[model samples]
Target chain A: QQQVRQSPQSLTVWEGETTILNCSYEDSTFDYFPWYRQFPGKSPALLIAISLVSNKKEDGRFTIFFNKREKKLSLHITDSQPGDSATYFCAASVIMGYKLTFGTGTSLLVDP
Target chain B: EAGVTQSPRYAVLQEGQAVSFWCDPISGHDTLYWYQQPRDQGPQLLVYFRDEAVIDNSQLPSDRFSAVRPKGTNSTLKIQSAKQGDTATYLCASSSLGGLNYAEQFFGPGTRLTVL
Candidate 1:
């Protein structure tokens, strides 16, 4: 069974617009949620993360809105720029757990 | 500080052949992980070690896959026999043992393996 899932396998947005990526998980024990961004032929890098205690986490133009009740979360990228084009992965894990259960990923493209 | 480094960025093998991938984590990082990512899919944990101890390897295919972090810094993942289904990119990641950012993991460029 897939513990984590992401919607809209691919998305495109105009520069200066906001792009929203959705994610959902089936494991309630998961408390730590992180998002990773990967460029072609490169490794995935951590972009932002949030704990269950917080409903939202914002870093610059990237924001993560989390809903524990629904087991869903969304990443919002404001002022989207062409440089932000990459594949975003949503991952979840239990506190202190060493392994992460990752979603398939959402490929984002920002057209200037 | 330098990031994680992987060797033999690319490898190609025929069925029944064996291959090994190596990883060197950042200095002082006590935890190391190995993950396999098939094309168009997310990375899947294969094994992990904390200071030379295997923490979890339930996802690993023991029949052919083996990994070890002998010195708690460098890790090696070996496959006894290759198969077409084993084609994927193997990634190495590392993190500190204790800190406010312990959950954060830094990854290497990864080794792309193609098995025919």
Candidate 2:
């Protein structure tokens, strides 16, 4: 049972365009949500995250819009750049442990 | 200031061979986690430890896999008999205690193991 699912396995957009990646979870107990980015031949790095109480969290050009009722959330990258092209994973956890349930990653390619 | 560090960045072994991977988490981080990531797939948690005690390892293939954190600073994952199906990248991550759940984790470069 896939506890977390992501849409659009792959995406391509021109530089400066806004790109959106969507994620949904099945576990209601999952209150911690985080987005990670992975580059070729490297480890996945934390990009941004959100808690249940917040509907939105923004850091610079990255924004996360979360809906608790729908059990869904999205990552929006404004003014995307070529450097932002990488695999993005949405993860959730029920508690403050490190056992994360991850979603199938989305491969984003930003063309210059 | 150092992030999580993993050893044997790449390993190749034949079926039935034994292999081990090591991880050194960030200093002062109390929680450590290991994940297996197949090509194009999301990472799957295999095990985790908090101060030398295992928190969860239900996903681990008990028959062939084992993990340990003796001093609470570093960890080792051993595969007794590797199989071709075990080919994947092993990732190590760590987070602080106060931010264990809320604080994002730092990841290592990972060890790519190939079982022929």
Candidate 3:
């Protein structure tokens, strides 16, 4: 069973458009949520993350809106640029947990 | 500081063969993890270690897979009698900033394995 799931397997947007990616988790015990970005032929890199204590977290043009009751979260990229094109993964872990569970990735493509 | 490093970037093998991937974590990082990523899919954790002892390896297919970080520095993952389903990119990551959960992990370029 997949503990984490992501929607819109693929997405396309014009530069400067805001794009949203959705994620849901089955494990309510998970308290740490992190987003990772992977470029072609490169390793996955940490982009942003949130804890259960907060409902929203933002960094630069990226924002994450979370709902504890729904076990759902979304990543929004505002003023998207071509360089932002890549695969994004949503991951979760319980506090003090030793590992991360990742969701199926969303591939974002931005047209310049 | 240098990032995580993996060797033998690509490997091709037939079913029933064996192969090993090596990794060297970043300096001063106390935790290491290994993950398997298939095409168009996100990575799945296989195992992890803290110092020279294994922290969790439940996700690893123990019968045919094994890993070791004897010196608490470098590690090796071996697949015995590989199968087609085992084909994927193996990534090694390390972290020290996030405590036990490792809020942020630095990943390696990964070693792609192809089994026929």
Candidate 4:
């Protein structure tokens, strides 16, 4: 029973291109959505997040567009860089995301 | 300030063997979390704590897995009678109770465990 699901197990984009990753969850009660990126051999780091109250959240070049009605979300990386190559994960939770349910993850390879 | 710290970054064990992983959370953080990440998959929550109190551990395998944050600052996860299915990376994370970094868990390097 995969609570969260991500599309395109792997993706590649040219530097400076916009990279989009999609995610969806089964639980309608989920109120918190956070994105995390993990570099090879490193731990997952929080990138950005959005709550049910907001449909969009932006942090510099990274933005998250969420649709509560659709129970879906997407993370967009504008001006993607080669250094941004990593595995991106989408997670959902009901209470501030303490008990996170993560998707399979998207491996993004930015070609410079 | 130092981020969350985990010791013995790698471990290899035989089936039925027991192993323990340790973690030291960031200073002043009251919440701690432990996750199990299998290869090519995202991390899954095993258990979490808030100031030595077990908030949730329903995802943890009670028979073989047990975690303790006795003092709340440092914690340990032990797996008894490890199985091949237990092979995965064990990650430890910490965060403050409130503020801008509320859900921003500071992760450790993680322990890569391989059960043969």
Candidate 5:
């Protein structure tokens, strides 16, 4: 069974617009949620993260809105740019372990 | 500080062959992890260690896969007999194990393995 699920296998957004990527999980034990970005032929890099205690986290143009009650979360990118075009993965993990359950990923294409 | 480093960025092997992937984590990082990512799929945890002690490896394919982190700095993942289904990208990540809030994990470029 997939523990984490992401919607919209791919997405295209215009430059300067906002892009949203959604994710849902089946595990209630998940307390730590993180978003990662990956380019072609590269490893996934940490973009942002949030704990269950917080409903939202923002870092500059990136924001993660988490709804722990629904076991869902979404990553919002404001003023999207070409540099934001990449595959995005949402992951959930328990507090006790380093293991992460990842979503299938969303490929974002920001047109300039 | 330098990030996690992995050797042999790419590898091609025939079915039934054997291969090994190596990784050297950032200096002073005590937690290391190995993950397997198939095409269009998310990374799956294969094994992890905390300073030479295995923390979890329940997802590892014990029949043909094995991993070890010796000296708590470097790690090696080996496949006894490669198979076509074994093709995937192997990633290594590291984090400080000290009592800090979950540190952001740093990842290596990863090793792409293609088994024919």
Candidate 6:
């Protein structure tokens, strides 16, 4: 079974606009949530991460809003740029856990 | 500092053939993980180790897959018999458990395997 799930298999937004990608998880034991950005033919890179203790985390123009009670999280890209076009993956893991459970991913496209 | 490195960037094998992939994690990182990513899908964890000791490997297919991190710095994943279903990109990632930055992991370029 897929423990982590992401919505909107694909998305498109204009430059300077804000885009939101949603994610949900089934395991309540999960405490750490991270977002990864991967360009084609490259490895996934860490974008932003949030611990359950916080309701939100931000890095530059990327922000992660997490709702632990709802078992859901969303990644917001402010001022979306064409360079930001890539596949975004939502992942969850337990603190000190050995592995991360990843969602199917969302393909984002930012058009100038 | 160097990032995680993987070798044999691409491999092709016939069914029933055997293959191995190697990975070298960053220095001073004690945790290493392997993940399998199918086309258009997210990566799934296959196994992980903390300083040469496997912490979890429940997702690995034991009948054909095996992995080892004997030196705590490098690891190898071997498949005894290749199958078409095994075609995927294998990724290696590493992270340090020290301080408050333990949640981040560095990934390798990955090895793309194709089983015909």
Question: Could you report the DockQ of all the candidates, in the order they appear?
Answer: 0.72, 0.73, 0.69, 0.72, 0.70, 0.70
**Is 4 or 6 the stronger prediction by lDDT?**
4
B46-81 per-residue lDDT for model 6 (tens digits): 999989999899999999999999989899999999
True lDDT of residue B70, candidate 1: 81
Rank list by DockQ: 2, 1, 4, 5, 6, 3
Misplaced by over 4 Å in model 6 are none
In candidate 2, list every pair of residues with a backbone clash. A96-B101
Stretches of candidate 5 off by over 4 Å are B97-99
| Native contacts kept, each candidate | 0.73, 0.78, 0.73, 0.78, 0.68, 0.70
For residues A1-112, write the lDDT of model 3, one tens digit per residue. Answer: 9999999999999999999999999998998999999999898999999889899999999999999999999999999999999999999988443488999999999999
Q: Would you list the C-alpha lDDT of every candidate in the order shown?
A: 0.93, 0.93, 0.93, 0.93, 0.92, 0.93
Give the per-residue Cα lDDT of candidate 4 at A55: 91
Q: Which candidate is the best by DockQ?
A: 2
- Candidate 1: interface RMSD in Å? 1.7
lDDT of 5 by residue, B12-112 (tens): 99999999999999999888999999999889989989899999999999999999987899999999899999999999999884786666778999999
Candidate 4 lDDT over residue span A1-112, tens digit each: 9999998899999999999999999988888898999999999999999998899999999999998888999999999999999999999888776778889999999999
Reference-based lDDT, residue A6, model 4: 99
> In model 5, what are the clashing residue pairs, if there are any?
none
Error of 3 at A93 (Å): 0.7
Candidate 6 local Cα displacement, residue A80, angstroms: 0.4
C-alpha RMSD for every candidate: 0.9, 1.1, 1.4, 1.2, 1.0, 1.0
- True lDDT of residue B116, candidate 4: 88
